[model samples]
Target: MKTAARKTRPAFLDAKRGVGNWAEATEWLRDRGIEDIECITPDLSGVPRGKMMPSSKFTSNTSLALPSAVFRQTISGEYPEETGDFRYDPLDGDLKLVPDLSTLSAVPWESDPTAQVICDIHNTKGEPVVYTPRNVLKRVMQLYTDNGWRPVVAPEIEFYLVAQHEDPDYPLKPPRGRSGRTITGGQSYSIAGVNEFDELVDDIYDFSEKQGLEIDTLIHEEGPAQLEINLRHGDPVELADQVFMFKRTLREAALKHGIYATFMAKPMQDAAGSAMHIHQSVVDARTGKNVFSNPDGTPSEAFFHFIGGMQQLIPKALVMMAPYVNSYRRLAPGMACPVNNAWGYDNRTTAFRIPNSDSAARRVENRLPSSDANPYLALAASLGCGWLGMTNKIAPGEPSYKTVNEGTTIDLPRGLLEAVSLLESEPDFARIFGQEFIHTYAGVKRGEFETFMRVISPWEREFLLLNV
Candidate 1:
């Protein structure tokens, strides 16, 4: 996996620092003639939760508050009665939302000019709410900072564009393209297939530019109407914020065309599932050099250790990667998904892959996280695993030269509850992601799994009504 030397720092990484400060944000809104503002934050499930108000009120009101219980909510929007050993504030305490000015962007789909800004959660005492997903990422980043390392990440998200439907029980189908016909076959990397929705693709590009997001590439995936977008590599936090906002922006853009853009891990029964594959590398904070490569232009000890860390700890952190009952469906034996945490060079079959690149751009691509995962938590968990490897000098197993497919043994948790229990019991994960956060997350996911269990699926009714 050797390649020619290239520039270590790219322009997009430098451009990520745009739109910082209060004056800049105000000017951005004024320039766009923005009237409304959506002050938002990502909950445990990566869903946006916060208040919407007039732009003027948003700038004036720095005291915006949301209930602390927002972090305790499951993907289904239900709260758990018992949160393991962690007790919620009896009063359901209020938390302040402080805007991250860099995230301020225009809501391009709004008929009326509107803006959206991501916020950080803080308690009345002015301390960060540790259990919040954003803060949890920051906690992990701070660990890297302590070690004089800065992690950079690029996320490749895959999702499906399905026909608009209201019924929960109805099966999802591919949305019709500009040709006025539904996509009926897998069209991986087909230029003609991508052109079928040229108008929608144009809107996606237009909306992304308005929001200052950079898309590295776009390709048609193996599923009908399933597309993949690769984001330029940059700071982990900034990339996570972009992914969070991009999901909403994509859905809004899809709705405008009378279709639904779904980030579900497994939307259809037979189609390939969606994934959020993350490519990551760590840089020396003091020196602007990739820590994974040495001066001799070869892989460094840090590179192997990082992979070792991921291999050692990612299984314990599977709950963060595959966060739901449906998420597990995406992690099964086939359809190009990894059933185990095997590593290899240029092998898609392995969960961790060292892509063919020059020393300066050397990185590991973690293909574990589902599209439905909280980007903040997913990046944090992935990076946290690598951090442990580097610090502990953990050695990774030999890379599998042979194809590791469905016939290969599975090394990951098979279900949501199984994944949750592994995360809850791992002390190393609790040390990286806060203890209380782990407890709260486990409780919320456990509750969601229970809720899913009570439901009677169509498959069960069809098979067991008279036969069993």
Candidate 2:
């Protein structure tokens, strides 16, 4: 009897030798005395979505399943269908989440020896959820990989530490610093300002170490109680994961110190807004050479084209970079934010900044993304736009020394409404970033804008309540 050939054990199912083996992760966790794990995924707004489970389950065949509608969840706990005539089914069907074994690490602040693992979403048919922010990033990264190149990124995120505000009506205020005094004025780059919050800063460093986050520097920003933390440069995906956890880590550390850590792009109108500036460069995978620079230590055509691509796409992709109504507040004139969608060497006035660096380290610093924007989506859009430039060979003209004063054709969008309108009309944007994603993103943001418009703000009550 010619029996069916015996099925050979594939390396994946074999578990003893595979890239995505969970058994190895479980063994590593047990060696470290971890008893539980927090499975997490960053949603559209960058908020973490997932649950905790016993670490022992990592070795089991079971996977985490969550409703597909979770992706459509608004910041206000409502769905798009409830507020609009969108055609998406918005079903309650479950999508399986596969844990990334590489992300398994211990949670420092937890009472239990709990670890954390970031996950990728997959549908019932075992296909990746292309619209998931992380998956979208992976898809764009694939483009680089296909071209024998890899992207490196470093994220410098600025944020605020404020006293808890119990009432939503009151504006957030800076908490008393470690010197037992509140910051009543700006303290940009003041060592004394950093010293005022020594304990909190120490906790940030300590927690960062425990979590394996390579946060190299902390400096006082222009705003009172504002600080910028820089994560060491590395792979784009790895850096995005670290930034995602770093925000939560800082928040937990802040709460333990009786302060609230906020990444809200514009927590206070009078204070300088927070920005998560991402520095990026591409390197040849085989030779480890920077594609952005020529052999003689000069910027290459690829570099200029990359910048050109970003300039054309930044306005169209502003919705992804800013992502919130308050985000536009930070992008105004005189805020030291953006003026024209111009490129310049070592100039912060332009949205795309080419920081002064040697040939090997030549990179572009995207200064537009707010602290509130999703790291994965932001990187995808930024990198994706650059890819479009490289492939299409877009030309970036002369660097404008003075962005605001420079008579340039760059038409910067002033609000979320305008940004969304611009986004909807971009032909190449929907083509590369996926039409479904662009539609979903713009639609959701539109819903948010409508909801925001319906609200009566304090300014309205104070100014137009009786006069109008």
Q: Which candidate has the top score in TM-score?
A: 1
| Position 381, candidate 2: lDDT | 87
After superposing candidate 1 on the true structure, give the runs of residues whose Cα lies further than 4 Å from its correct spot. 1-18
Span of 10 residues, lowest total lDDT, candidate 1: 9-18
Please report the candidate that would top lDDT against the real structure.
1
Tell me how candidate 2 scores on lDDT: 0.84
lDDT of 1 by residue, 1-468 (tens): 898889674333333224767766666666667799999999999999999988877766468999888888878888888854756779998999999887877788889998888999999998998989999999999999999999999999999999998999989999888888999656999998899888889999999998889889999999999999999999999999999988997998888888999999999989999999999999999997999999998999999999999998999998998999999888888767998888999999999999999999999999999999999999999999999999999999999888887674688999998998999877888789999889898889888988999899999999999998
Alpha-carbon deviation at 191 in model 2, angstroms: 1.4
* Candidate 2 local lDDT, 301-386, one digit each (tens): 99999999998888788888888899988887667687567788888888888898789999999988999999998899899999
TM-score, cand. 1 vs. native? 0.95
Clash number by candidate, in order: 0, 0
Report the lDDT of model 2 for residue 45. 83
Query: How many Å off is the CA of 292 in candidate 1?
Result: 0.7
TM-scores of the candidates in the order shown: 0.95, 0.93
